[model samples]
Target: MLNKDTLLRIGCFLREQTGKVAVYGLKLNAQAVYWHFPKSIACFLDRDINSGFFCGLPIRRIEDLPRNNIHAIVIAASLSAESHIYARICDFCDSHGIVIYSLYSGKLKAECLGKAFPAEENQESELRKAIASHDIVSFDIFDTLLMRKVLFPTDVFDIVEKRLREHGIDIPGFKNYRIQAERGDKRHKGLAGIYLTLAEMLGWTDSQAALVMREELAAERQVLVPRPGMGEILSYAHDIGKYVLLVSDMYLQPEFLQEVLAENQLTAYDELYVSDDRGTGKGEQLFELVRKEHPAETYLHIGDNAIMDGWSARVHGFDSWLVPSALQILKTTEAANILSFAENFNDRLLIGLFANRTFGNPFAVREKLVSVKSLPQFASFFLAPLAAQYVLWLLQRAKIHHFEGVLFAARDGWLFNRLYQAAAEIMKLPNVPPGMYFYGSRKLCISAALQEEKALEWLKGHLVGQTHHFLRECFGFLPGDGHIPPAWGEDTDLIWNEVVDKKESIFARSAVIKDGYERYVARLGLKREGRYAFADLCSQGTTQCALTHSVLPNLYGLFFARYMSGSSVTMGRVETFLPQADWHMLANNALEFIFSSPEPSAASVDENGNIIFEEEDRSDKELKLLDEAQEAIEKFCHEFFSLCESDGFISPAIGHFLLSMYQQPIFAGAGKVFDGMDINDNLMGVRVDCLLTNEK
Candidate 1:
C-alpha cells in the first residue's frame, strides 16, 4: 500500500548515501534491483552456488555478511515473498547498524534510476515550473514527443526486409545489414541511403534497395505514434506561452517529419529541427542556432537522452530535463523480470520497447503487485485489450469481405458474440450489421445434415478404425439405441449396417435427426441466399463444412484456428496460439472452461428443435470457479466497451502478445496463471484424458 512518493524518498536516500553498497537479492535473481539503487553497488549477498553471480564481484554469505562500510542493502525479491525473507535481513541490518532498502516493499516505478523514465504521471509540477521559468522549451521528437512502436531503432529494418521480400528480393541478412552495416559512419546518407549501401554491399540490384527504402519509409509512417500524454505536454507549453521546438538527431528529413506530424495531427510546435537538415547533432550547434534566432529567452529542453538533452543544454547555459525513453523504461522492467522469458538484457529491452509501442506496457503496475491475487482484475488489464481487437477485426472483416452476417457459432462463439455486442454498444454502432450468436455445434450441424447419402458416407469416412461406440455417439445415437460392439484396427472395416444391424431403427433415427435439424433452422428465422460466416474458436471446418455441404451452400468459416481434413492446410493463416489437436484440445478446453457455458455439450434436439437437456447438476467447486472466471471475463468486456465509448481502443499487437501467454504450458504453469484451473466436461465432469495430468 506504499505510494510511489514513499518509494522515491527511499531511492533518493539510497542514492545520496556514499560507499560500497551491496545488493542482497541480485545473486538470487531478484529483478529490478538496480532500478531502485545507486550506481555504487559493490557486492552481492547470496551464497547459493547455482546463482548467476559469476562476475568476479564481491559476494557474501549470511555468516560472513558485512556489518559495516557496506552503505545499504536493497531487497529486490518479489513483493509477495520478500517480507518473510526481509525479516531475517532486517534483524541483521538493525544489529549491524547498516542501512537497508526494501525495493519490494516500495514502488520501483516511482524511482528515476537507470533507464526508468517518469511519465507525466509524476513531476508535473516541476515540469510546469521549469516551463514557466523558461521562455522556450525544446523536446526531443522521437521517444519523447512521439514513440515508435519497436524495441530498438534498428528493429525498423525488419520492416524494410519485409518490403524487400515483397518486391521479389529476399535478403537473408538484411536486418543485420540495417543494424550493423548502415550506421555510425558517413558511408550512407538520407533515409534510404543506408539501404542503398546495404544493397550494394550485398550485391543486390538498385531496384531491390529502392523497394527496401520504400518499405522503410512506409514503415515509419505506420510505426510512429504520440506517446501517452505527449500532446498534453505540448499543450501545457503552448498555454504557458512558451516557444516549443521539436528536435531530433534522426536521419529522416524535416519534410517527411512534418508530413508524419501532420498525419498524426501533432503540429503544435513553434518550430522543428533535425540533424539530417543541419548536418550536425543536438549537442551544441543546434542549440546555438536556436539561441541566436530566439534571443533574450531561457531555453528548457526535454529530451530522452541524458547526453543529448541534459549535458548539452547545461553546457550551453540552457535548462534541460533528461526525459528517459519509453523504450528504455521497458528495457529496465524487462531486465527486472516482468517478462519471464527475457533472458538477455538487450533482448528484454527490444521486447519491452516493442510492447511499449504496441500497448504502452499493459502489465505496468504502478502500485498494484502482479500476482494470482490480481487475476480478478485481469479483465481490464489484460483481456479487454484483446477483446477489443477481435471486435474491431470482426467489424472490418465483415464490411470488406461483403459477408451478409457472421454467425458466432455456438460455444466459444456464443461468448464472443455477447462481448461483440457489448463492444458495438461501446463503439456507438447501434446499427450493428448482421451478427448473431447462432446456436450451432459440430454435433448439431452434423446431425441436421445427416439423412443424406453423402452424410452417411462422411460419417463412414470419420470412423477410420475407431470404436463402433464412437461411431454410434458420432451419429447422435441415444446411449444404447443400437447394439454396435467395439472394435479395433482392421476389424472396423465391417459394414455399417452389420456393425449396428438396426436399419429400421437407423431410418427412424435419421427421420428424427433430419426433422430436428430442419426445425432448428426454421426456428432461427433466417432467409435464403444469405452469405453467412461460421465463427468459432478453433474450427476444423467440421460445422462449417457440414452446414455448407449438407444444409447451406453459402457458408464460409471465420475461426481463430482451423485444422485441415487430414493435412495441416488451415482454412486461412490463423493468427493464434492454439494447442494442436494432436497435442491438446485447446478449443475444447476453452468451450468448456474459458467461455461461459452454463451447460454441457449440445445433446440431440427434439423434433421441434427444442434443446433437450442432459441434466446434470455441476459440482459446487467447478461451478464456483467457472462462474468466477466467467464473471471476471464479462466485466473485462464491459470495461473494454467503456474505453471504446470514450475513444480508447486497445491495439492488436498487444492483444496477440497477451493471448500468447495463455498457451497450454503457461496457462497451467504451477503458481502462475490458471494454476489450479481444470479442464472438465460440463455434462458428466469427465476430465479430458490428456489434461488430467495437470488436474492436481
Candidate 2:
C-alpha cells in the first residue's frame, strides 16, 4: 500500500518537478500511475519500436518526446536484465538535457525520496530493513516465494504439453497457440480470454478449452515444488507478525493460485494479488487496488525479475529487491571462466546447462585431503544421474512397448538392477513390467556356447587372447601353472573330456557341458519360453545367443549397451536397445573397467545355484583392489538410489557430463574427490575373452 511515507515522497517529488515527465515502460507500473496518478505520467515510452499501445496512450520512443514539453523520463524498468534499454535511453536523455531518473536507484526503508543511484547486490540486509518498515510485506510470489523446477519460466508449458499428450489430446503445434493464448490471456485477463482464440483457430469448444485448462493445472501439480530458501524467509515474515500477501502479476486467478499454493504447502500468505483478477498487472494500476485494500500500510516487494519486482515496485513508491537465481549467476560468471578448459561447444553447453538445472547441496569439494583416494566422486556428479536416466528410460520403454518384467543379468547388471528396483519402489512404479534378477554372466553362458562341433571350431579360432589364468579360472582346465594350454584338435567332446577329467569336478562341469546346462536350467528354474528381457551391462549378443542355441529360446537381452554380432538376435529376442555410436563416449575403456565385480564372473553355476570362481589361485593384492572398487561402486549406488526422487529427471545434458567423466577424467582435475584414484585395470579385463575377438 502507498501509505503516509510513500505519499509524502510523492508530494516532495511533485514539489521538485517543474515540467511533465513520461513514464518509460508501458508495463503494469505505468498503467498503475495512469490509473492512480494520471497527471504524473504525461505519456508512455516504448524502448522497442513495438506498436502495441497500452492504456489508450500513443507510446513514444525517447527521441519522439518533445524536448520543451517533457523535461524528465522516469525509467519504470529494469537495468539488471536485457529486457529494457538503459544506456541508449540514458544517452538520449542526457544529450537532450532531459533528466532521467531510474526507479531502482534505492535503499528505501523509511523511504527517503531520492533521484540518486545505488548498487544491487549489497542490499539483502537492507532489504530486511525495508521489510521491517512495512506493515505488510507483499511478495511477487513466482520467483520470490515459490519456484519451478525447470530451466525457464515457460518450461511450465512443456510439462502441460506432455500432459495433453498423456491424455490423448493431439493438438499439433500447440506452442504457437500457447504463445498466442498468453497474449490473449494478458489482454482479456484470464483463460476465458483465450477461449475465443482457441475456438476460432482450432475449432475448440468451451468444454475443450476447459479440459485443456484442467490439464494445464494438472501439469502444474506435477512439476511444482518449493524453492530452496522458502522456509527461512516465510518463517521470518510469520514471526515478525507482518501481514504477508503473495502479489503476482500472473494470469492465474486467485482461486486457481490457491489450489497451487495449497498443493505446494504455501498457504501462509494473508491474501493473493493477481493481475488477471483485476484486469491490471504489476507496473500497471494493480497496486492501486493493493493501496485501496490495505490503506495506510507499507509494502516491500521481492522477486527475481528486475523490472516488475525491483524498478516497478520502486516507481510505485515501495521498497523492492532483486533475487538473482543461481542459473543467472552461472550464465553470467562461471560459463566464461570455464571456456578455456572446456573440451568443445557441446561440452561447455552441458556444463552450463547442468549447473543451470541441477540444484542440491554443493560438491563436498574436499581440501587438504590424504595422498591417496579410492575412487572418483563421479558417483554423485555423473554415475548416479546416468543410472537414474537409464532406469527412467527402462520404465518408459517397458510401459510404451508392453513387455514383460525386466530380468537383470548377473555380474555387471548387479548395480543397474538394484538401482532400478530402488527407484521403482521409491517412485511407486511397481507395475512397470515388474522386474527380477537372472543369474546370467559370460562365465555362466560360455558353457551354453559349446553346443556343436562348429561352435568349438569358432572357439578354437578365437583362443589366442585367452591367458593361462583365463583358461584355468573360466574353463576348469589347466590346474597346473602353465603359460600355454595343450593344443586341441577336431574332436570337441574329447577335448572337454580331458579338461573335465583333470579335476575332481562335479558332473555338472561335465565333458560337453550338456548335462551341466540341464542342471543349470533345473536349478535356476529358467523356463524354456518366458518372454522376459535379460538385463546386463554390455554384450556381443552372445549370452542371449548361447541361450537361444540351448533352452530359453524366447528370452530377450537388455544390455546397458551392446556390440553387434553377425546375428542381432538374442535367443529369439531382437536387438531392441543399443547405445548410439556417439555414445561410445568412454570408447568402452573406463566404464567397462568400472562396472566390474571384485571376483571374475562365475565361470560355472551348479544345480544349487552356488557360484564357481576362477580366482581361487590368485594373489591377495589383486583381490583386495577388486574388493575396494566394488565396495566403492556399491556405496556410490546406494547413495544415488537414496538421493533420486520422482520429481527430478536425468536430462541428456546431465548424461553428456556423465559420459565425459568416463571419456576422460574430467572431474579428476577437481582433485578433491579423485586426485589419485586408480582404475583396477586387472579387473577391467575379464579373465576369459567374452567376445572371443576376431583376431585377424
Candidate 3:
C-alpha cells in the first residue's frame, strides 16, 4: 500500500536536496518517508494537523514556517486528493521560494477502475426502458433495494466482534475467523453453515456460535436502510403492472431477508430468489432457477453487481441493468482516498457513518453540490459527532481530574451543557461533575475584573475602532459627549484613556458586575470555594484569567480548543479537547455557531440577579436554523452515546478527517446549513462570516 519503490525514489530525491525538507501530508504515504529516511526530513506540513508529531518529526503549518527554513515540500496524499492538495498549497510554497516535490509519480489513476457498475443515470434510464419492454422485472435485494450503513458487507463482522467483546465474549480476531468461515465453507449452506464452520475453527460450542449468529443478524438489522432512489424505480415497476421479483446471491436466510424487506416496506415484489435456497449462486445457476419458475417471460434484472446481476442474468436470457454500488460510486469522488484510509474499528465506524449517510443513494455525490436540503440530517451526520466527542472528552477529563462541578459558560455553552448532560446520563457515568449553564461572557467577565491590571490590558487591546461601540456592547453603557471624538480615527485612544481616567467609576461598575455574578452563582447553587470548571467553545483564557483575578479562584477553564497558547494564569488551570494542531481547522466563531443557543448573548447582569442581554441581532430564520441544528446534534448524541461503548475517546485523527471532509467546498450539501449565517462577537461589535459561507 505504501508503494515502497516510489518512496525509495522520493527518499533518494530528498537526500539530494540541499536545504531543509518537509512532507506536505500526514497520512501513511508521508509517514513512510519519515520511517525510512528519518535523517532526510526536517518537518511535516498538513492543513488538518491532529498531532504535534508524526514519527518523531515536528509538524508545522505551511504559514507558520519561517522564510528559507524549508527548501522543498513533498506531497504524500493519495492520487485522488493529491492534485487538490497540491493546487491549494503550491502558490504559498512558490511565493515563499520553496520547491515542491511529490512522493507519488504525479500520475492520476483512472477514475472508475475495475469492474465498477454503470453510472446512476444510465442505469436508471436503462431500467425504465427494460421495464417498459419486459413483462417481469427482477431486482437484486442488497445494495440495490436496501443499503447498509457500514462501508462494506464484511464490516458487519467487525461490529459483531465488538458487540461480543462488550458482552465479555472477548474473541480475539473474531472478524478474521468470521470472514474465513464464510469464504471457506460451502456457499449454499447459508448463515448456519458459516457459523458451524466458525465454531469448528474457533472451538466454539454450538450455543456460543448461535449467540454470535444472533448478534450478526442484529447488526445487519440495525445497519440496513432502504435505497430510496432504487426504491422509486421498484415502485414504478409495480405501479405499471409488471411482475416483480427480489433476487440476491447471498448466504443469508430467505426468511431473514424477507423480514428485513418487510421492515423496509419493500412490498412491491411478487417473488423472492435466493442463492442459498436454490443451492446455486447468481453467476452460476440461480438465474436459471428463476427462469424455470417464470418461463417465457421477457425479464429485466437490475442490481449493483455487474457480473452476478448483469452477465449472469443475460446468460439466462434476461435483460440486465447495472447500477454501481455505493462504494463504487464513492470511488468517483474525492472521498474515495479518505474512506480507504480507515483501518480500525472507530475509524471505520466514522467512515461508515459518513458513507451510509451520504452515499446511500449512490448518485448523491455525483453533482458535488454543497447545499444542504435537511439541516437536521446534516447536523446528525456532519456536526454531531465532533461536538459530541468534544463534550464526551470534557466529561471524561472532568472525572479524571475529580472536578467538583462544571459551569457551561453562557450562550454557546448552553448547547455544550445540554449535550454534556444528555451524554453523561446516557453513559451512566458515576460521580460525573454537575454541569450548569453559567451566565458568563468576555464582556461580563472583563467587567467583573476591571480592577485587575491584566483585565485592563485586555480591554485596551480590544479598542481598535469606535469607543462608543466598545462601551455600549461591552458594558451596556453609553459614552459621554467628550468621549465621542470629532474624527473616526481619533476616538479609540482618546476614549480608552478617558475610561482609565475614571478609576472611581470603574471601581463602582466592577463592584456591581462582580456582585451580580456572585448572586447569580449563588442562585445556581455553586459555592465560591467549590472547584467549578467553566466550559467554553474556545478562548485564549481571558474569561478564566478574569474569573481567577476577581472571583472563583478555585475555577478551571475547559475549552474545546484554544486559538493560541494561553495567558500565564491559565497555564495549568485550563484544558482543551482539541490538540494544538487542530486549532486552525475551525475558527472560534464557527465553533460558536455550531455550539449556539437561541437566546441572545449575555451582555451583563442586572442588579436583581437577572441576565441583561444584548439585542437579538440574529434574525428569526437564523434562530430557527440554530434551534434545528442544535436539536439534531442533541438527538445524535443521545442515540450515539446510548449505543456506542466508547471510553470517551475518539481519535483526533478521525476527527480531523471528518472535519477536513466537511470543510471541502465539494463535499455533499454541507455548505447549505451554514450559508448566510453570521458569527457575532457581541462584546467586540464584530461580525465574522460563517466558515462555510461564500461557497455559493
Best candidate, lDDT-wise? 3
Candidate 2 local lDDT, residue 540: 59
In candidate 2, where is summed lDDT lowest over 10 consecutive residues?
361-370
lDDT score at residue 148, model 2, on the 0-100 scale:
50
* Every model's TM-score: 0.48, 0.62, 0.75
What are the candidates' C-alpha RMSDs? 15.7, 9.7, 17.4
Q: Tell me the tens digit of each residue's lDDT in model 3 across 374-444.
A: 65666666667677677777887788788889888888799888888888887677789988888778778
Candidate lDDT scores, in order, read 0.57, 0.54, 0.71
- The backbone clash count of each candidate, in order, is 0, 6, 1
Provide the global lDDT of candidate 3 against the true structure.
Answer: 0.71
Full candidate order by TM-score, most accurate first: 3, 2, 1
Q: Give lDDT tens digits, candidate 1, residues 350-399.
A: 34333453234222323322233333433333444445456666765565
Candidate 1: lDDT of 340?
53
User: lDDT per residue, candidate 2, 1-696, as tens digits?
Assistant: 233443444445545678777777777655655666566667778757545567876677666776538877665554453224444565566667776655443212213321112334324455566667777777777755665544455555655555576579878667567877676533354766765566667888888888887776665565455555553566577678888877788766689788877877777778888887876666555655776788754666666666677665665565665665535443343233443444432233334333433321111112211122333333334444455556656766666656666767655666666667766775555567777666556546656556445554444333333423334545546433333443322233434545444433422343345446656665655566656666666565656666666556666665666655444432345443435332233324334444554555555655554656554433466446445554554544443333233333334445534445332222333323332223322221333321112210
Q: Per lDDT, what order, best first?
A: 3, 1, 2
lDDT (Cα, 0-100) at 83 in candidate 3: 45
